[model samples]
Target chain A: MTKKPLILVTNDDGISAPGIRTLISVMKTIGDVVVVAPDSAQSGMGHAITLNSTLYAEEVFMNDGPQKEFTCSGTPADCVKIAIREILDRKPDLCVSGINHGSNASINVIYSGTMSAAIEAGIEGIPAIGFSLLDYSWNANFEACKSYVKTITENVLKNGIPNGIVLNVNLPNIPETDIKGIKVCRQAKANWVEEFDKRKTPQGKDYYWLTGKFVNLDGGEDTDEWALENSYVSIVPTQFDLTAHHFIKDLNTWNLND
Target chain B: MTKKPLILVTNDDGISAPGIRTLISVMKTIGDVVVVAPDSAQSGMGHAITLNSTLYAEEVFMNDGPQKEFTCSGTPADCVKIAIREILDRKPDLCVSGINHGSNASINVIYSGTMSAAIEAGIEGIPAIGFSLLDYSWNANFEACKSYVKTITENVLKNGIPNGIVLNVNLPNIPETDIKGIKVCRQAKANWVEEFDKRKTPQGKDYYWLTGKFVNLDGGEDTDEWALENSYVSIVPTQFDLTAHHFIKDLNTWNLND
Candidate 1:
């Protein structure tokens, strides 16, 4: 008998989110699973880790295929920290995060809990992948995404990711058949142009809800935004190093020490 | 009389950190300062923003100086968002963050509240910069950095930063006389080799504290790490476009559509 691969599962949408639940169901077919995830939704919480308060991760559920689950009071990145440092018996063979309710394509990867979890695992030297749906609706169809998720996870398990790199996978909301196979792409040049909805409080205090339109400046058909538009599952091999290395030589000209 | 340059101030160490105090003091000499920062410390909070909770910015202090201040209940990025949308009478001439207690050089910038606030402002079309001291101690010597900070800020104010570009300035901890001038540099290839310090809880459970030693892999004297080592204030021109444009072409070769 072969040993099942150890899989660490997490998500930004809390432990009970339908996205993680679906992901967990898929993982059971491939490995021995351990889940450590936020107790509540943590969408748009890019790369946050807990330091101020004591993290609380309780083993809340068991008996579903011998997998243990912990509901954690931390960000998705924090969940990965606690799992690797305190909870897991050994390092995971793979770390998979999300089937997120919203898109994490283009520039959104920088501000995404889904992708951050994957990046955290990559930092720990574990191969990881983050999956997200183009649809933001809670009831969006995830059934269409299962096979591709399984395939990508399997491919990662077979061929390890390069050092300092992880995978950022975004799926379109179309049906599985309409979905083309995964296309490895780069993060698109995009950003949210915030249009703050300024309103007054009932007590006459002014407040604002941070809202915006995501603008894609990159028109390249090879970009993630373009891949998803053409119904392909986009896979961006992402890294944790945020350094803009190309600008280093130009900066050396400044007389900083004088 | 010439109108004072409109300066927006924020920090990762909350509105009340000594770091921001030093930053606020310096900015007052150069501009009409408007401070909107988190009410509590937000160290190590990487690019997180408030969404689940409503944000509130209160007039926390009325100072004797020309600067006005507000304490916000949000992350460093949120402070920038709130300031740009509501607090400022017009777009700020320059946005400055930190005098951060620890280093934000190399890989730390990705996980820095100080730098992220500046990055957030830069993303929103504001000319911004994040400053840091190499020393982590609260009593870190900032006096030596005063003139350099003012010079850099003034040059930036006089010659606006390019659209979508900001600055990441790291000051070496040393005496004023020993300090070298500033250098334009690039982020070094570096990482934190995290060592998890695990411990047992009172209830017989286990928990862990995340700690690490940074490993600098870039041997180039032209990098930020090298700049700091040479006692120069490292100024890396940074941008918020997270697109990996180089990787897009390779992704198009994948057999996704077939």
Candidate 2:
């Protein structure tokens, strides 16, 4: 019999959120699962790491599960760092983060705590994937994404991800039968037009709540936004290397040294 | 006289840091400057935005500079967002972040609050550059890089940065006379080997502090790490889009749909 792969599971919406719980359940079926996730919600955290603070990671037995779980008092990236460097006995076969309560598609990936965990793992030279649902509510139905998630996870385990790359998978908020299969796509050129909801405190001081409308500026049919809009699960092969190689030549032309 | 370009200046080391004061001084020579920076140190904040908290921007009179300044109670990314959305009367011609108290070269960009502010501006369609010094002390001699900073800032203004790309510029900590010129380069493949400083609290509870030694694994002479080591200022054209376009075809071959 083939040995079950050791899978490291994590999420940004804290250890007890339904999204991670669903991810944990799926990972348990395929591996010797070890979960090290944030103790509280860390949505929109991006790639933040703890530097100026102390971190606490305590083992906890939540539900009747075979997985060994710990709740970390740090950002998602910190959780991945601590897990790989201190928690796990050996490097796991794969690292997966999130069945996130909202979409981490397109520009959202830039501000996503979910994808940040996966990116942290990728930086550590581990194959990783971050999964998200289009719905944002805590009670979003993550069950609809199980089989698709499993298929993608198994494929990653079998084929192995390219070095320096991690997967950003987003499922449309639809039933299983309506998910028009998974489409390999690119991150669409999209952004949030922030509308700060300005309000005053009791002492007449102004404060702002960041609220924004996501706008998909790209019309490419091969984009993740188009895939999700068409009821298909989108898989954008994301990278952490932020270098714009094509423009490096143009930058060299500048009279910088002169 | 041609209208001076409206320049937005910000940093992660709080509004009072010498690094940003130096940046503000340099920017003042090139344009009408507006300084909107974090109220306190927010290093290693990455691309995090203020989503869960209320944002406060208070006008402050710091040093004797013509630059309009505000101290923001948010991360570096939030400073950029609120500057563009609420503070600035018009979209600034350019956004410059940092003269960061440390090197944001190579993989360090992934966790830099300095770069995040510049990247946030880039995402908002503003030409941006993030500047960093190799020194990591509060009193690091930022004066040595002033002329070079002016040179690079002028070059960027003259030749507008390509759409969707921001410059990540790092200067070696050397006397200005000994500086070996500037080089446009790629981000080096490098990472930190984290050593969690595990300890017990006074209450006997276990806690940890994250510490690491950077290891540059790449041998390429054309990387930022190489340039910095060779006493050259490095300018890496950075991008916000995380798509791994080269691997899309390979990912399509996976049995994801099947």
Candidate 3:
């Protein structure tokens, strides 16, 4: 019999969140699961890693699942690093992060701790995927997410992701029956038009809270944002190489040497 | 005479760090300058923003450069957001981050707080560049970096960076005379091979310090790692779009829907 794939699971939402808990249950049906996720919520952490401080990871029993779990005192990227180097006995066949509480599509990917964890695994040469639901609530329904998540994860295990590439999968927050089929698409051109909520402390010192409305500027019908808005699951094949290969020729024409 | 360009300067290193001081001085020679940098060092912060916490920015006098400076209690990305939305009188013409005390070359860009600030500005439709030196020292010499910094900044003002893109520029840590001309290159495939320095706390609890040796897996001479290694300053035109456009066609062939 073929050996069950070793899958490393993680999320930016602390491990106990329903998003990850639902994710954990889905993975248990497919493989030998090992979870090393942040001990607390690390939302908006991006690709941040702990450098100047000490890191602690403690094994814990969230429940009586066959999967072993550890709570890590670092960002999502740190959890992946510690899991690969210190915790796992061997390389994981697949690394899946999230089932995150919010969207990680378009410009949101740059600020996503969920995508960062998956990207971290991709950097380490593992085939990885980061999954997110459009719902941002703490009690958002993840019951609709399981079948889609399982399908994608199984497909990934069957057809491996290419080197320097990972998947950013964002699910629409709708009933499972209402969901359309999955669509592979590009990241949309979008940005948060930040409006700082300026307020004062009790002592009258000025401070601000970061707030914004996401503006989707891309008119492309073939974008992740469009797919999600149309109730289809979006799978944007994400890459770690940030290079704008098309711009290099134009930049070389500049008079830098002269 | 043309009006001076409004330039916003920032760094992941704190406002008082020599790196930003030099960056500020160089920017002043080209434009009217404003500095909004971290109050404390925020290295390795990646693209993180201050979403979960309050942000504070206070006007501070750092030396006698012709730049108005604010020290912000936020990450590098936060510094840019606050600078543009809360502090600046109008939208700045350019945003330059770092003269970073270390290299943000190759895969380091994924974890760079310095680059994140520049990227933040780019997302907001401002032309941006992130500069870094190969030397990782509190007292790395900024003298050799000034002329190159000035040249690059001038070029960006003259030739605006395309929308949805930013520049990741890394300088060789050599003398000014030893430096070759700038080379526009792609980011090399590289990553850290992490080694956890496992240790026990005073109370006998286990902990670890994250450390790693950077491994350049790519031998391509057209990469940022190659340019920096050959003593040329490297400028990688980077994009925020993480979509793997090449692999989308292949992903669509999968039986995800079936």
lDDT of 2 by residue, B159-236 (tens): 999889999999999998888899999999999999999999999999999999999999999999999999999999
- In candidate 3, which residue pairs clash? none
Candidate 3 reaches a DockQ of 0.92
Q: What is the Å distance of residue B249 in model 1 from its true position?
A: 5.1
- What is candidate 1's CA lDDT for residue A1? 100
TM-score on alpha carbons, each prediction: 0.90, 0.99, 0.99
Candidate 2 segments whose C-alpha is farther than 4 A from its true place: none
Candidate 1: TM-score of chain A is: 0.97
* lDDT for each residue of candidate 1 in A1-258, tens digit (9 for 90 to 100): 978899999999998888888899999999999999999999878888776656677888745567899988888988998888778989999999998999999878878999889988987789999999988887878998898998888877876766677888999999888986788777787778776676789999977678878998888877889999998998988876655666555544444334
lDDT against the true structure, each candidate: 0.84, 0.94, 0.94
User: What is the model-wide C-alpha lDDT for candidate 1?
Assistant: 0.84
TM-score of decoy 1: 0.90
DockQ of each: 0.45, 0.90, 0.92
Q: After superposition, how far is residue A28 of candidate 1 from its true place, in Å?
A: 2.7
Best by lDDT: 3
